[model samples]
Target: MRIALLSYSTKPRGGVVHTLALAEALAAAGQDVTVWTLGRGGDAGFFRPVDPAVRLRIVPFPDGPAGESVGERILRSIATLREHFDGTGYDIVHAQDCISANAVDSCVRTVHHIDHFTTPELAACHERALTTPYAHVCVSATVADELAAGWGLKAEVIPNGVAYERFADTDPAARDRWRRRLGRYVLTVGGIEPRKGSLDLLEAYALLRERLPGLQLVIAGGETLFDYRDYRTRWETRAAELRVRPLVLGEVPDDDLPALVAAAGAFAFPSVREGFGLAAMEALAAGVPLTVRDLPVLREVFGPAARYAATPEALAAELAAALTGDDPTRRTAGRTLAARHTWAEAARRHLAFYRCLG
Candidate 1:
C-alpha cells in the first residue's frame, strides 16, 4: 500500500511525533509511506528526519505574520499539496487535522481537537472540511463520541502508542544525576496551557506545600502554545504567595525526556481536555506512577492502571502518597499496561485501516 501522511504545519510537537511514528511504522511493515510536511522556515532543526524507508515531500510556503488567518494559509497549502500529489497515486492520504487540505485521496481524518467548532466562521470551515468522504479516526473514544454527538460524524478510536524500549531503558547514573540536582519532585510534562490545567497543577502544588514542605514541582515543556502569559503570570504569583518553589524546565529535548520521567518521584497530569495524553503514556512507560485527572480520555487510556484524582487537593494527596510509598506495585502495573500498547500493534491496526480504504 502507498500511504501519504499529511500535516500542513508539522513541527516538533506531539501531533508531528504521532505522524512520524505512524509513517515509520507503516514503512517498516512493508508499506510504501510518504510524508507531506511544510518546510522549516529557516532552521533545519525544526524538522525531524524520517526513517530511510519512508519518503518525504516538503512543500514550501510563506511563513507570514501571526495576524494571517490559519484557514487561508491551510487552503493555500492544500492547493500546493494537490499539485504535488497529482501523479504520486497515493493509496490513502491520512490528514492529521480537521482543516488539513490534502484529503484528496481515500482519506482518513484525525480530530486532534474540536476548538474550531466553537466559533461560527471556524465551525463553517470545519463543517465544510469534515464533510469530505473520508474514514475518520479519533485518538480517543471520548473524542470519537464528541465528534459523533456534535457533528453527526462517527470515527474509529485508535489510541496513540509509545516506544516502550526507549522509555524503559533507565540508566541509574543519569537518574542519580537528575535526582541529586532536583531532589524528590512531582513532574508535569506539557505546555503551560489553560486546557492542560497547568494553573490548576500550580494551585494544587501550593496547597500541597502547606502540608509537605520541601516538595518541589518540576514542569517540563515549552511556553504556552496560546497567549496565556497572563495565566502563567498569575500562577507564578500564586506560587510565590504560597512560597512554593517550581523548577520550570521549559522545552527539554526528546532524548532527555525518558531520564526526566524516570528520575521523578511521580508524574502529574491534571489536564481538563486531551484527545490523548501522550506525556502521561510516556511517563507510565518509564515506570513512573501517574496521578491524572478523572477525565474520560485518561480513564480510557489508563483504566484502573493509574490513580485518579477529581480535585486539586485529591491530586496533591495522590501525588504525595505515590512519592512517599515504598510499594512498587503501581509502577509495575503501569509498565505492564504500557508494554501492552506497543507501536507494532498500532502499526498493524493502522495497516488494517489503510487496507479498508481500498
Candidate 2:
C-alpha cells in the first residue's frame, strides 16, 4: 500500500511521534509509507532521527506576522499544508491531528483526543476535523468512546506502542550520568500547560518538598504551538511563593531522554486529560515508580501498573510513596505490560483497518 501520514509539526509532540513511528513500522512491514509534517519555525527535520526506510516530506511553514492571533495561525497552517500536500496515489492518507485533518477532506484521521475550543475559528476547525474524515482511529478505548458518545463516530481503537528497548534497555552508565547531574529528582515531561495539570503538580511538589528536602523537581520535553504564557506565569508565581524550584529543561536531547527517564527516582504524570498515557507507559518500560492523576483514560491505559491520585494532597502522598517505598512486584508488572505493546503489531492492525476501509 502507498500510505501518507500527515502531522501538524516536525516537533516531538505526541501525535507527531505517533505518525513517525507508525510510518516506520508500516514501512518495515513492506508498505510504501511516507510521513508528512509542517516544519514550524524553519525546522528541517524531526526532533529525533527517523527510520531511514520511511520517507519524510517536511513542509516549510514560516512564522506568522507579529501579533497574529492563534486563530489566524491555525487557518494559515491548514492552508499551507493543504496547498503543498499531494495526497494523490496514496492508498491511505491518514491525518494525525486537527490541522492536518482539516487540511484535506476524504481522508482518515486519528483522533488522539478531542478538545473543547472557545475561539470561533478553532471550534469550527475542530468540528470539521472531527466530522470531515470518512474513517477514524484512536489510541485508546476511552478516546474512542468519547467520539462515539459525542459525535456518533465509531473510531477504531489502536493503542500506542512504546519504544520499549530504547527505554527499557537504557544503559546503566547513561542513567548514572543523569543521576549525577539531577540528583534524585521527580520528573515529568510535556510542558507547563493546563491540560498537563502543571499547577496541580506544582502544588503537589510543594507539599512533597516539606518531607523530601533533597529531592528535586525536573521537567523536560515541552514543544507545543499554543501560547501558555499566562498559565506559565501563574505556575512560576506559585512556585516562587512555595519556595520550590523546578528545573525546566525545555527539550532534552533525543539520545539522552531514555536515560533521563531511567534515572528519575519517580515519574509524575498529573495530566488532567489524555488520550493515552504514553509518557507514563515509557516510564513503566524503564521500571520507574509512577504516580498518575486518577483519570479514567489513564486508568484504562495503565490498569494496575501505576499508582493513581485524585487530588493534589493525594498526589503528594502517592509521590512520596513512589520515592521512598519498595515495590518490586509492580516494577515487574509494568515492564511486562510495556513489553506487550509493539509498533509492528500496531502497524499490522493499521494495515487491516486500511484494508477494511476498501
Record all residue pairs in model 2 with backbone atoms less than 3 Å apart, i.e. clashing. Answer: none
Candidate that would win on TM-score? 2
Backbone clashes per model, in order? 1, 0
Off by over 4 Å in 1: 45-48, 66-87, 101-106, 116-126, 223-225
The lDDT values for all models are 0.76, 0.92
Candidate 1 residue lDDT tens string, 197-253 = 887888788877776788789988753223467877887788788777799898777
Q: Each model's TM-score? A: 0.88, 0.99
User: Per-residue lDDT tens digits of candidate 2, residues 150-182?
Assistant: 999999999999889989999999999999998
